[model samples]
Target: MRARDVRAILFCAVTTLILLIGSYVLLQSALISLALAAGWLAWLLTRPRMQRVIRRLRGEPDWNGYFRND
Candidate 1:
């Protein structure tokens, strides 16, 4: 893997840890924090731009009708 990919993964992991820790600290409940995180992730994944990215990753036809092999 490239250094860029490694950095991106680490960034995402740290951000997620911070979010979980912050959420727990503010909300005072593990379950609620987890739920909030799950909801947030769902919202992100369902966004149009993310959907396009996901489709591209899954080898689906893109917006311009270009087929990817994944």
Candidate 2:
């Protein structure tokens, strides 16, 4: 709906596309290409910035706020 959301989606699409094509070209295996793309995405999502963005998108409380409350 939002521009930021659209940009994020586009980024993910492009990243996955590049990874899939690159891995497939290099290794010539569909399954391995998919696996590598998934692995790459999983790694990216685990990053602190991505985690915070995901939490915020889910309407969850921030780590700083939670810590200050305790």
Top TM-score: which candidate number? Answer: 2
Residues 1-70, candidate 1, lDDT per residue (tens digit)?
A: 3354355446555766787899999989999888877876777667665566556557766557533344
lDDT of 2 at 26: 96
Best model number under lDDT:
2
Candidate 1, pairs of clashing residues: none
* Candidate 2, 22-56: lDDT as tens digits: 99999999999999999989988787656666776
Misplaced by over 4 Å in model 2 are 1-9, 63-70
Q: For every model shown, what is its TM-score relative to the native structure? A: 0.61, 0.67
Lowest summed-lDDT stretch of 10 residues in model 1? 1-10
With candidate 2 superimposed using the best TM-score fit, by how many Å does residue 62's alpha carbon deviate from the native?
2.4
